[model samples]
Target: MAGTLGIGIITYNRKDTLRGVVDSILRHTSTDFEFVVADDGSTDGTPDLLRQLNVPCITGRNKGISWNRNRILWYLKEEKRCDWIIILEDDCFPTVFGWERPWIDAIERYGHVNFMPELTIEIDNDISSGRGTPEDPFIAPMHQAFCIGYHAKALSYVGYLDTRFEKYGEEHVEHTQRFLRAGYGGLSQHLSPERGQLFYLRGGLDTLPSHSHGSHELAMRNKTIHDAIRHEPLYRHPWRNDEEMFEFREEIARVLPGPAPEPEGEPQLFDSIISLGGDELVNQAIRNHFGRPGPGLFDQFIAPFHTLVSLFRHDFSGLLSTNCLYGYHDALRCRDTLLIYHNCLEKQPGEHASVEMFHAQLPLLRHRFHTMIQEIDSLCHRSRRVLFVRSWRDGFLYAGQHRPAHVASVDFQALVDALAARYPSLDFRVMFVNFGKAHATDSRMMFANTDTPDTCPRDEELAGWSRLFSTYRIGLHT
Candidate 1:
């Protein structure tokens, strides 16, 4: 009466090792578990081998080890809804019949477990002193990533591997730490060979047919990222935010077969809308107006106040900030309609803009502005029409006595003119929404609560905002 179990073998370009591992598992393991091979863009006839073996495979482009492992987790824990999952590397193989029995038992008790390929006398002594028994395995300080098992509950709580680590290094270590932080027991050390046996390891740098995808340089890079974020809060998702999550899901859908069908809904006014600066308040207003579910890329993404220069500092490829990444990916997915809403009043309360700072960064800002426009033009090439709703510092900021003088100083008209002339084929239109009067009481013209600043517009206020957007006449056929 055990719950459903899933076993996934993560393989790269190691067809021979993968085949051997599959053969060994089939020959030795007697567990009735759903099994599949996850191929990480293996170029070496691995698909043919899998077909010849008639093994079900989840294949995707090479996004590195953490991504590959995440695919397995998403497939088994998220899609298949398995009660327990076991991840085995292509180089690891079973050594004895019913080797999965101990793993299943250990996972059921400890929630997370890692099986050792071979045991040394030192490990044996440690196990004996550490209350290791056939009934209860010894909990090691760390667990191997090569052969690991997790109960679905624990997996769900700990979440997927951090995809920030590329190629593979400290991702496993970071994942283990996150698991431990979640208050889950990890059983890594097993009973001695006389008591029980687990997997057999092969194919490292020292071994024949070494299939190591890791390099010292890659490890160091991953280690740097790991050390930087290890002390920070755990980021469970493979994606950074909703925008990245959407992009990643789309990427997976395109590569893997049998993607889920798109949900039925009324067509939106725009194919995609990118909100800049206004936080979720503006995003929520848009969604409420259009009957959309959630914010699209850049919708809720926030940049540091007074750091507008940072947004234009790099080309799309060089942009490394999470907000910029979200914008880039979301822009790639846009096809028909693209709307960019930029609010000038994203500064903190009582924060005043300095004219001197603007003049100091003017040269760099001009260069970056050109680059930003070029990048946007390239990214939105597929869109039939593009619209920019540029809200100037007006009644909203003036009412709160917060003057973004530097922001108001920028000639947005010239920027828009440049963009329209450069990308005439894109049918670009720029709408300047400015409430000239400071005491403009029209709820539709200004936000309801200017004091709170971050508050979302109420239903009537959202209606007013929608009406105001509609007046721009950017050709929302919907």
Candidate 2:
């Protein structure tokens, strides 16, 4: 039977090379098959690159080669429901125009195969002879884990390849040999160096491990192989059913230690991201520090309700149910974090209220926020600074200078200078989001602003006003 095919590439830090190999597989393969990229804690930009490719990627903390192999194998076998899995290293490639058909044919005919098959005499005494030199093909059950396809059900006859060989060097090679020695072998084809169909990248050497531990690894794998042959390996008797195994662990401490105290003497700028499970305590904490809560769905319950309700009534006054009023009051409390704009304003501007002057000076606002974000990032010790600038009054700023009654305000410049003096060594401004008319006016607006000389003094402008006007648009999608 032409079996179901699943292909997976086990990759580490070879981001660029893996991209080439993945692209080749996607562009040149002949048949459709399930594909997954198994990554093992690649610290490079590999993870980010995988996301860009939109590939199915599974990441796990580094636990050596066997961990990666077993993870992908288990995932494919259990979750993917693939009948035959073709496991390839990130550096492998197909030589022929349509290499998948031959792969399926090989699996159908031999039960297991690799594109480049440099084989040996295997002595099973019946049909196989001495399989030699393999030294360390993979040490996993298949001997040729590099680019081999295997029938999923074959594991039923021969139990799983022992996974205890955690990178003692030729560990995988030994397991491959062991899987084969158990007699799961079938048809064999020795791939000549010249056979122009399938191949390995850069002669098939991976980008990791200095092999300085080869002898130690060889001895380790040899012992495991010997143990399995003697039926002394712990996994010798295996679970044959199709049920998924589950595991859970408990923390057995009465008083769990709290998080490590953040080091003293730094005013860090870590963005306080709120999630669904959050409560008012966090809201209050944020208000205590930052002066304003970050953009939120919670505020939508009242902010918009009041705005829309104000439109229908002659008086801009409306009553929020007590719960909402209290919530808004709580949310509006000032936070301790160095808020860019704070009570320094002699006059407190209602949240999201537009200052025609700030809006009118949109160009300067945009540039200022762009610069401040960078400075904040540097001062906050290279931490992310999310600056949110939004406006509910879409047309108010663009309404051309009926400006707010000129109210006296605290000198905003002094507050910023004070914040800088307090947190000198910090990095700031990673993402700045401009919402509603604030974004529109700052980014794409071509209209004229009559709020000239921008009547509002710099200190009186709202918090995050510059981010809305900044030339550098970072993560403004929201």
Candidate 3:
């Protein structure tokens, strides 16, 4: 009996390469299988291309490779209920006819298979060796994540790829190691046929366009995470906990609408209104105002030090970029309100250094702030109006209570002035909220302040805040 088979192609921003691979697969393959594309937030015309090809696709925000692969695994194994699943990257192409036959057979015997592409001299040498036949391929250690196959039984035992891995690197190696430790057979390799090889590597294709969104910093960070948890017990779920799992599932249910439809004539750009601050206060206010919150690139609670590092380095990969917002790109283009908050300068007992330390870092802080505003301006080019809500420093409401010593020393207004002067096209407005003694007077604010680090205004107060924002729409100010 021939078991059901599902083939998934994972793609990012490679529209031309994806089109070639999809065409190649359709022309060269003659197997009965379910096919789908897992798109990782490709802003570059890939959605329309997929619709033109009429291929079923599963898409989400620009999470890293591991998370994107999990979308395929979840859809094929859990939703489609296929007995065997084969994963291929957009850059990988099949050169031989009936290419899916050997892979299906190999998975039936070994439970998993990773095809070796003819990219390097060593791989070319291995393929020349006539060790394994087409019917039953040679067993080798799992390497290379470009093309892989997994049995449903093996998937049930192993689990989904770890989403903690940011961008690219180390995720595939860790996953394959876990598979081997679980007593499953390693990947299968075989000699090439006279017609062509089983798969063609992206490196060997010189005619196609080459584009990479990965960086050394992201790879190094992922390597550190791999080293820390490679030896731990296997994780059988995609998410960190039940809450995350349920949240992700809910997001999938809400966003995954089968294959994407062709976009209407000439995509229109909408004016963007965004809020950038430090912490969940900003997120809460946006959520309260919109009646529902969309996915934000920096929606989570971030530490003051890390936020500063992100600004200084201009690194927005990993947690800083990924969020609960499902169709992040689509939502970002249409949504009018965006809230970006961090806790870099937030005052918490023992959480920050002495005021003297902040003073010493004032120059670096100003430079980082300048870099941050420049980046924001570049990112929100579609928006004509941008608003920065400056949350008050701790103890701002209490009389005679001293604020964090860094508050008065750092000149945020100067940094904004320099950048705003350079970029004349964007309208930048800064609003400072001073809830003078409101914590003591207002019962809602009082109750909200009972929790440490919850210095944001309550949901009820957001209505008045919105009205105040509309009142100050005259010109750019600090």
Candidate 4:
């Protein structure tokens, strides 16, 4: 007769590990359970090996471990070959005595409830505090283990392994928690007589090291997923539909492969970019610092900037530009990082001139700017930096003109000079873009400024402004 329980294992490219686990299972158990391995696209020789084994194995399209497991789960349920499903990881193996009698006996006794074999981290034990220590007890929650039974009804109710937790961190805990929350009791048995073996090359607590150290990371992820599920329309289950979970796991794997290189110990020089109002200079600056395009020259040139913006607006990749903020919403949203604004005013006669002619505008502008500054200051206390970008006409001297002297208040040079003096201890930079004319207009808008003198000099100052503006934009983007 066919076995009552369906044994399942998840594997990737590790052929040696898989061999060990399967070998242990064969040697230990007397019952004839159908062993199922959902191989996640193993390019290594594992597929051939699985075919050679006398067990039921399913090769899954390797989207990732989570995706592979979930995808094949439907197949397992439809087959209806067993009453309970026991899940294990390729890295873990069951021992002889511990495997045959203790594990199977425990399952036979507590078949209705979920069963988890005693897991042990068997890598190194020379250090006493390592595995078997008081902190690292043998009894614990189910991990990627040798035996975890899932009733057919339970699998149907809970669905499948969440593909969101793509790699390893918390998918198991997520499953276990859900099982418990659903009112299912789980049991663990110290397999006796040692007929089978479930061993791992690395990872487990000391002597009896069994439990994973630190609280399960999935708990935090679970909370986040729960919250997103509640609020975000796209999220299915607050607990499982996780794209971030995969990111978090792979990140840990990447760090573990090599000794973590200390974060490029705080670079010597950094930038504080204060963007003034509308200009293409900011975009130009980013391209310079981060490097240029590859062979596909035409596509690079033609793709609309907005298209790229939309691509990056979601969490597909890291920020392309120095974290940018344009309008009021952006300003408020980014109150934590850098706050940018278009504070430059259009040319006005004496009445509309800056605070010099109209001292009244000074307080208003100061109040607005000051509030932003205060907000930034508060964030600074919480450990965030602030940058403000301002731009103005180069030659529009208000000394003799009725133009409010305060209009020049946004002058790049004056502001930089004063800020340097006032906040000598704080890091800051001011950039000047000397338009051919002394107006706050963009380069394209320069022609519209009627106040521009008919015979403006070749404006050598334009070079300084251009250089400074380019540098500022570059700094902000980085």
Kindly provide the TM-score of model 2 when superposed on the true structure, using C-alpha atoms: 0.41
Q: Lowest summed lDDT over 10 consecutive residues: which window, candidate 1?
A: 330-339
A best-first ranking of the candidates according to their lDDT comes to: 3, 1, 2, 4
Can you tell me which runs of candidate 4 are displaced by over 4 Å? Answer: 1-3, 71-73, 97-147, 186-478
- Give per-residue CA lDDT, model 2, range 1-478, as digits (tens): 5556788887787787789778878876777788778776688887789778977776645545555565556556655677777788776766455667655655555455543333211331121222221221121112334576666665444444444545434444444443344444432232421111111111222222212322665666657654555334323221122111110000001011211222444343345322110122223323433554543332222223123223223221221211211111213211221112211112245543223332354465445544543443343443344332212221211221111212332222332333344345432221111111111213211111111112233332332233222222222212
TM-score of 4: 0.35
Greater TM-score among 2 and 3 belongs to 3
Q: What RMSD, rounded to one decimal, does every model reach? A: 17.6, 19.8, 18.6, 22.6
RMSD (CA, Å), candidate 2 to true, equals 19.8
TM-score of each: 0.48, 0.41, 0.49, 0.35
Please report the candidate that would top TM-score against the real structure: 3
What lDDT does model 2 reach? 0.40
For model 3, residues 377-478, the per-residue Cα lDDT tens digits are: 674564565554434332212221112212333334443554365455665554334322122221111101111112223553455444443343312211
lDDT of 4 at 130: 21
lDDT of 3 at 444: 12
lDDT of model 3, residue 216: 90
What's the residue-level lDDT of 114 in candidate 2? Answer: 48
